[model samples]
Target: MKVLAVSSIGGHWIQLLRLMPAFEDVTVEFMSTKQSFSTMVDGKKFYSIPDGNRWNKYGLVKCFFAILKVVETSKPDIIITTGAAPGLIALFIGKLFSIKTIWVDSIANCEQISMSGKIATKVADVVYTQWGHLEDNKVKFFGNVLG
Candidate 1:
């Protein structure tokens, strides 16, 4: 199975990387904001998309189109993300394309699922919250990197 993992920098990126060993035998590709971020991700294919975040509305729009292009070319069978916003955009596209999607809300949001995670519940095949207390009918809690 081909899995495309997408996440922003900082904690989101770190958590996504920790999930790598789990995808060992599968074809995995990565998408992020910077080439420097690609340094931690060795061997696998990495596509550096435009840098964007919640405050950068313009950048997010550009990144959205860039993500669309990547989705078209890479044609990932599944998409997973530890998100902020960019990852959410990719999940939306992945859903529209009929690609399976997973949204792992950041461990930082221990009390509640992030806004993006709440939105993902409608589209993603699965939504995971690292905090066990947050688990419900839609979100699953299956431990985390911190554990």
Candidate 2:
């Protein structure tokens, strides 16, 4: 199966990388806010999307289009993310394309699911939370990626 793994930079990227092991048997491509992150993936296909948050409407629009283009070109069977904004955008785009989507909320949100994650729960086929306490009917606790 072809998979597009996406996230923003920093902790989200790190958490996404930790899930690489699960993609070992499948074809996986990486996408993030920073192009420099391509190097960390060791020559695998990589895409860079604009980084945005709820505060930056313009940037979010750019990110949405960029992710839409990537989804169209990559044509991945599944799209997964450890999200901030870019990942959330990808998930929405993936759903539009009828691609399976998975969202792994950042481990940093120990207290509650991030806002993006809450939104993702509606689109993603499966939404995973690092904190067991955060699990509900919509969100699932699938163990911590960092650990």
Candidate 3:
């Protein structure tokens, strides 16, 4: 399977990296907001998209198009993200291409799901919350990336 793994910088990126073992048998590509992160992938395919958030509309638009371009070019069979906004945009683009998408909510959101994660529950094929108490019919609890 060709997997496109995406996330923003910081905690999201850390969680995404933690899930790398799961993609050992598959072809995986990495996407993030920072170009410097490409080196961390050990020569694997890497893409960089502009970072964006709810507070930045223009940035979000740029991020959306950037993600769209990556999705079109990578043609991944599955797109997975430990998200903020860039990853969310990738998930939306993945759906448009009929690619399977998975969203693993950040481990930092212990009190509640991040806004992007909540939206991902509707856009992604599968949505996982780190907190067991947050699981429901749509959001699932499958062990967190942190532990």
Best by lDDT: 2
Taken over the whole model, the C-alpha lDDT of each candidate is 0.92, 0.93, 0.93
What TM value does model 3 have?
Answer: 0.97
Give the Å error, residue 3, model 2: 0.4
| Candidate 1 local lDDT, 1-147, one digit each (tens) | 899999988899999999998899999999998778777877889999886777899999999999999999999999999997889999999988999999999999988999999999998999999999999999998899656
Model 2: lDDT to the true structure:
0.93
Local lDDT at 41 for model 1: 79
TM-score of each: 0.96, 0.97, 0.97
lDDT of 2 by residue, 1-147 (tens): 999999999999999999999998999999999999999999699998888998999999999999999899889999999998899899989989999999999999999999999999889999999999999999999799999
Better of 1 and 3 by lDDT: 3
- Return the clash pairs for model 3, or none: none
Over 1-147, each residue of candidate 3 has an lDDT whose tens digit, in order, gives: 899999999999999999999999999999999999998998799998888898999999999999998888879999999998988889899999999999999988988988998899889999999999999999999998888
| Minimal lDDT window, size 10, model 1 | 34-43
Clashes (candidate 2): 0
Candidate 1 residue spans exceeding 4 A from truth: none
